[model samples]
Target: MTVSVLICDDSNIARKQLKKALPEQWKESALLVNNGEEALEALQMGNFDLLFLDLTMPVMDGFQVLAAIKEQGIQVKTIVVSADLQIEARNKVAADGAIDFIRKPVSASALLDVLNTHGLL
Candidate 1:
């Protein structure tokens, strides 16, 4: 099965980096968004297998996005990818129902590991 992913990050560079790092097999199935608001909009528009979300953003933040998703009962799984590696950040995101947490500047192997762990590969 092809896994559809929504990537939310404020940095264009970060988005490009993620796009470049994702396995080529998943390229065509990925959707990139610039902020939490856009991510939420995309989620409401289509069915996605997973979400790669950044913690800090302008219009909205990852925490707010996750909370909104949970509040709306959206069922897509999410992996938090952020530069902030604070224990409290992880705990909060986890409490908000993120499936996993990945540090920023993520490597291809790390991304793959997450996908594999979630059985999305």
Candidate 2:
């Protein structure tokens, strides 16, 4: 089955880069959103299997999105990708239900590791 994926980030370049980096099959049906609100809306409207979330955003940050997901019991597995490389941030997101936390300027190796660990690749 094709895993439904959502990419939520404030940076257009980051979105484009991630889109480009994704395997063709995965990219074929992926959804991209600019911020957490849109991500939540998409989740409500779509059956996404995975979420790539950025922590910092203008309207509804990723932390809020995570909280909403937990409260609403959204089924998608989330992986936080942000420049916030703080250990506290990682611990908080993990405790909040993120399957994994990835730092920003995501390298192909790191992304591949996440995909592999989650059996998404």
Candidate 3:
């Protein structure tokens, strides 16, 4: 089965970097969103196997999006992809039901590791 991924980040550079890091095998199956609002909307409109979300954005933040997803009973898996490396922030996100945490400036190996651990690869 193809694993569909939704990438939500505010930075165009970060999005481009992540997109470049993703394995070519998954390129055709991923969707990119610029903010949490778009991510939530995309999740509502279609099914996704996983979400790579940023913590901060213009319209909505990752925490709010996550809460909304849980409130709405959406079943998609999520991972926080953020520059915030604070333990408290990580803990908060983990408490919110994220599947994993990936620090910003993500590497190809790191992306592969996350996918492998989630059994998406």
Task: Tell how far residue 85 is off in model 3, in angstroms.
Answer: 0.6
Predicted structure 2, TM vs. truth: 0.95
Give the TM-score of each candidate.
0.96, 0.95, 0.95
Residue-level lDDT of model 1, residues 65-91, one tens digit each, is: 999999999889999999999999999
Q: Write the per-residue lDDT of candidate 2 for residues 54-113, one digit (tens) a residue.
A: 999989999999999999999999999999999999999999999998877888788888
State each model's CA lDDT, in order.
Answer: 0.91, 0.91, 0.90
Alpha-carbon deviation at 20 in model 2, angstroms: 1.6
**How many steric overlaps does candidate 2 have?**
0
Residue 63 local lDDT, model 1: 97
The residue-level lDDT of candidate 3 at 121 comes to 77
Candidate 1 off by > 4 Å:
none
